[model samples]
Target: MKIQEIREIIKLMDQSTLDEFVFEAEGTKLKLKKHNGETRPTVHTSAQPQEQPAAVVTPKTDAPKVEAAPAEPIEKQESTSSEASSSYKTITSPMVGTFYSSSSPEADSYVKVGDRVNADTIVCIVEAMKLFNEIEAEIEGEIAEIHVKDGQLVEYGQPLFSIK
Candidate 1:
């Protein structure tokens, strides 16, 4: 019913496996829907804050149809991902957010390629809903690759690093 409550719900939804959420309380209806596997950057605008209102959904029957990716490319992607998983352990993002390599812009990166890390090592920060969460490398190994760059928007369960 409040803006903060709505934001919290959105954050939880982003971190979860659910793609759609709906709630009706006190004559007010709220619905949250997101297209999974389609990662898009969120653009924020500077404007005066306004009163909150229930979400409105409109059906778009005339929307253009999108063709799925070809089978060969999908197969190739699957093969590569499987190979990587087989050879290396991965550090994955637990929630969708903007990835930061350091605590701040002026600070050094938490870790780099060829750097060895333990299970408790903090590798990066993932900011979601104005909350910066420290991401840890859960496996002890050498950093084989960094999958994302600073300020990049990452999705839940997306690989952030490859460790050998």
Candidate 2:
């Protein structure tokens, strides 16, 4: 199928609130499905050439979760996933608020490139209302990448680590 025709069909779907489109033309059949604000394309072509374009649009569906890391590493971790070994310290929030790695816009971050931290170390700050509440590490480990940035709103259980 030509690229221009696919674009036009997608445009039509967005404008008309249509969720799925299927078309058959010149022994070639094409099906376009849109879900979770994303579009997926499927095409089927017959051996003999005939043009009979047809389009069908399906209903919207829920969005998939963020893609996970490869299965091999996760599988390795799964054997140890249930361990009582609290070797890594998780710096978590005390209250629901926005998380900030830096105190101010231009200041150095509370935790940086490779800082080691313990239970008492203030890793970052979670701002609730006008008050800034410092977040402390609950375990001991070298600093991994800070997941959220300064002034970024964080949900109660949002992850912020990749401890080794």
| Candidate topping TM-score | 1
Which window of 10 residues has the lowest lDDT sum in candidate 2? 70-79
lDDT of 1 by residue, 57-163 (tens): 32224544333332221111122434356778878887669999999999999999899999999999999878888888979999988888999998756888988
**Candidate 2 stretches greater than 4 Å from native:** 1-89
Candidate 1 RMSD to the correct structure? 14.0
Q: By lDDT, who's the top model here?
A: 1
Report the CA-based lDDT of candidate 2 relative to the real structure: 0.60
Each prediction's total of clashing residue pairs, residues at least 3 apart in sequence or on different chains, is: 0, 16
Please report, as a residue range, the 10-residue window in candidate 1 with the lowest summed lDDT.
70-79
Question: Measured by TM-score, how close is model 2 to the native structure?
Answer: 0.43
Residue pairs with clashing backbones, model 1: none
* Per-residue lDDT of candidate 2, residues 16-99 (tens digit): 544666666567777777777666777787899654344444545454323322212111121133432456434444445888
